[model samples]
Target: MMSDDLFETRDSSSREVFTRYNREDRIKKASEKVRQLHDPDFIRKRSFIKSVTENRGLRSVFFVIVVLVSINIAFFVTRSDKNNGRIYGIKTELKSFIYQDRALANLRLSENTKFLESLKESEEKDGALVRVNFIFLDDKGTKLSSSLQTGIYMGTELRFSSQDESGNAKKVQAEIYIKEKLLVLSSKIK
Candidate 1:
């Protein structure tokens, strides 16, 4: 019992001494800071901590502006195509029609579009079968919309024979809607 009392007394006294030492150290540092704050030379001197506090707002504002601008530039760059101007925004560019076939590799895309234009009307009048495909791009040439391999037909859809070419058969038999992403909505309907 006596040893326990001694231990308690020692622990309490040690804790009191430790706290008093910390208090004295803190008081000394605070007085030094107060003296520096009053000194013209210290005020004029540019220290790392001083500069950080003085330009805190400027630094944060500049960083925010830079980040916003970088995001805007990235968005515009990602939404653009080589052959076209701004897309996925305003309709600055007209809609463009592209043609593809088994022999598509033989000719360039421009050549195929030209070829399709000439043949499209003739084939339509003759009631020949034509195929159309679309790709929805997200941005940065990173993500391409893909059709699921459902069965024999890719991007498969069921249609009624009676309703085939039924919507705009008299005017135009084709429709390729891609929001405002292309130039030239479609070849001018004859």
Candidate 2:
């Protein structure tokens, strides 16, 4: 019983000592932290401002580059053939005609015929059948025409048809080349 009392006393005193020591250590650490916070060499305020400005500058530059690249890509995809502006003009006119008045399908078809006839002349002459192909490109790189077809006409359906020398008429290839991504490459069956 006596030994138990002694042990209890010793344990209590040790615990008290440890608690006091920890309190002193905590005070010392807090003081040191306060001193460091005020130290001139730390550059806490200046570094913070500099870092914020640098981060903002980098973010703005990145955003601007993304916007520029997107615009360039849109232009390259929609600009049509610069060499044959007439074809592009015709294409634009057809698109406008079809969309401006939903009832102008016949008018658009007639206009499309003229453009198609002009395009026939530009077909790459192969052995038996003429090959009709165009390259599509963007600021990023060559884009598949099929990829852009969804966005074309802004959710309006566009009709495409091809008539070969044998009078074999078929729907135009669903795939399109945006910037030479090889959306469609039909082989000559002849």
Candidate 3:
């Protein structure tokens, strides 16, 4: 009976020690979990990362839109208009004779005014003449025009003057037409 009591006491003490150890392990696990949940640095880092990912998607979309818009604008700006005809070169020059005689100048001035009035009527019927050299080449044929009477084929230099309704020398422009369609337009200001 004494041996049986001693065995019972040993078993009871061993069970008590196991139970105490199990309780301590459970407390440690719960506290570790709580600590992890309440950590300020970890929470802040997680929230900041989550916010950045959300905003990054929106920012990336915005950046792509901006880049596409910029590309379209550049393309349109660089593209040339095909409707308006091409102009190669424009040149203008003015020449005037000087007279020193006062009485002769006064007599000539009145006559010049009368001549200018007559010239104005004729100018209204025709577009202003511009000294130009134009060449048009296509599958149909080659057409050329120039200020020189010999035409552009001979490659001769020429000059022409244009006048406004007031008989004053002014800017001149001309449009070349083929089959009622504008081929080229050129102008010169003097």
Candidate 4:
């Protein structure tokens, strides 16, 4: 009779065991749904981090691009500053030459002062030839206060000038032809 009672208890506990298993399964499914909803972007962020960490070549490419861009900016800034510094030297030399030529022109009055003729009339052996035309007008067509025409030849030996204000060249322009081609165009500023 005890064996029959044991069989009855075992049959009853089976139902309770099933109920506990169902409760645990429900709790696990609910936790999984909550995780998916709360951390929707977790998968994408993990994939991105893994890809960057594993690919050495991609990381190196990014580093090289940054280094090259920085170097390019530094080189450009230094080169531009150097070019600006050279302009001051050119301006000072040009001003001194103009002042010296003006003072000397006051002494020579007998020479026929026409204008700077073509380079064909003169020869440039040293290759440094500057033909200056006494510009009488500005960019707005305003006349300058002084008028003088001189050409810097080779190393400052040959110069041409006009006889007087009336005989001076008009619309003065200096053309620096290199190898017989027009390379630079300069005008005298009074």
Candidate 5:
């Protein structure tokens, strides 16, 4: 009897216990329970938590996208300009930097030029002495009589206004400027 009772199969009589589950009955019961709750804040919090838990991958994807975009922005952004921070095209940025460097170089060159000019001017003001010799040459390039002239060294030039041995006012001639080791002379008699 005991062996037979243990081996025999019996059909369940309870409908709830025997049948497969469906969501319709569960949904209706859950909705009725939710309606009994009167607090909107509580419901909102619970729904938000449930939604976040269910769609977890969406949040991760959104976070990854945000991080990538921020990194991209960082790579292109720069504060090299001496002004308010703002984005500019790569070509425009390069041009501005190049122009700024050129301007600075030009400024330094101008300053150096001014300093040299001032030093030269000081030498001239101090009446720096210079020795000059005038050699008279004939048309055949033959050496003639030589004479000495009175002149002053004006930094790079030797200038004087003096007459010839005959003391003629019109014969006054001065040779000036031997810049960069070059000398040119042209005379016209009217």
Candidate 6:
């Protein structure tokens, strides 16, 4: 024999016992609601937008790819290989020499065509001096004579006519050292 008050259910307990909707049913309902609010074409068009918004890793990868592509394009557009392709200096044919009283060595220095073209292209940008140094070496690689010349542009001829008291003419090799700004070029003439 239980008491009626003990057997009676309370209103708070009845209220606390709530019903839960099914997962599939809730998803269907939400989809229907979305379809009613937005056009089908618009939803289809924006499906990728939802995916990109939900997938953080995918979005990061896409952002990185875009940045890399942009960087590559910028590098290709702004890069120039003109300086690397330039020629620094060249040794020209030796001119005639007069060796009456002594041994005379006549030499010519010429600017490389490619170097001149590059210089012309950047003439408006900056100015630099090109120093040409001529060295005469005998068969034994001994230094016979040397001369230095400086110019902003163009080529020049070097004439060495002063002969020692011996007045003996000797076959020697000529070397030209060209210094342009920070570039150095050396060449031997036969």
Best by TM-score: 6
* Total backbone collisions for each predicted model: 7, 10, 0, 3, 0, 0
Q: Candidate 3 lDDT, tens digit per residue, 62-98?
A: 6788899999999976642222232222122222222
lDDT (Cα atoms) of all candidates against the true structure:
0.32, 0.34, 0.33, 0.37, 0.32, 0.46
Worst lDDT run of 10 residues, candidate 1, spans 101-110
How do the predictions measure up, each by TM-score? Answer: 0.21, 0.20, 0.23, 0.23, 0.22, 0.32
Model 4 lDDT tens row, 1-190: 2443112234554545432234334445577656555564755335654666567897787678889999999997653211111110121112112343331121111121222233335564433344333334344545543443434343222434422242232223332222333322233334
Candidate 3: what lDDT?
0.33
lDDT by residue (tens digit), candidate 2, 1-190: 2443112234544534432134334444577667566566764445644554577777687678889999999998775432211223233211111222221111011133443454446642211121223222223433323212122221122433322232221112223332223233222111
Q: After superposition on all CA atoms, what RMSD does each candidate show versus the true structure?
A: 18.8, 18.7, 21.9, 17.8, 25.7, 17.0
Model 1 over residues 49-84: C-alpha lDDT tens digits? Answer: 567557779678767888999999998777443332
Model 6 worst lDDT window (10 residues): 79-88
Candidate 2: segments with Cα more than 4 A from true spot:
1-54, 82-190
* Cα lDDT of model 5 by residue, 62-125, tens digit: 6788899998777756412221111111000011112221210000000123333554655455
Model 6 residue 93 CA deviation (Å) reads 2.0
How much RMSD separates candidate 5 from the native structure?
A: 25.7
In candidate 6 the C-alpha lDDT for residue 34 amounts to 73
Model 5 / residue 171 / CA error / Å: 13
What TM value does model 3 have?
0.23
* Stretch of 10 with least lDDT, candidate 3: 102-111
lDDT of the structure predicted as candidate 4: 0.37
Give the C-alpha lDDT of model 6.
0.46
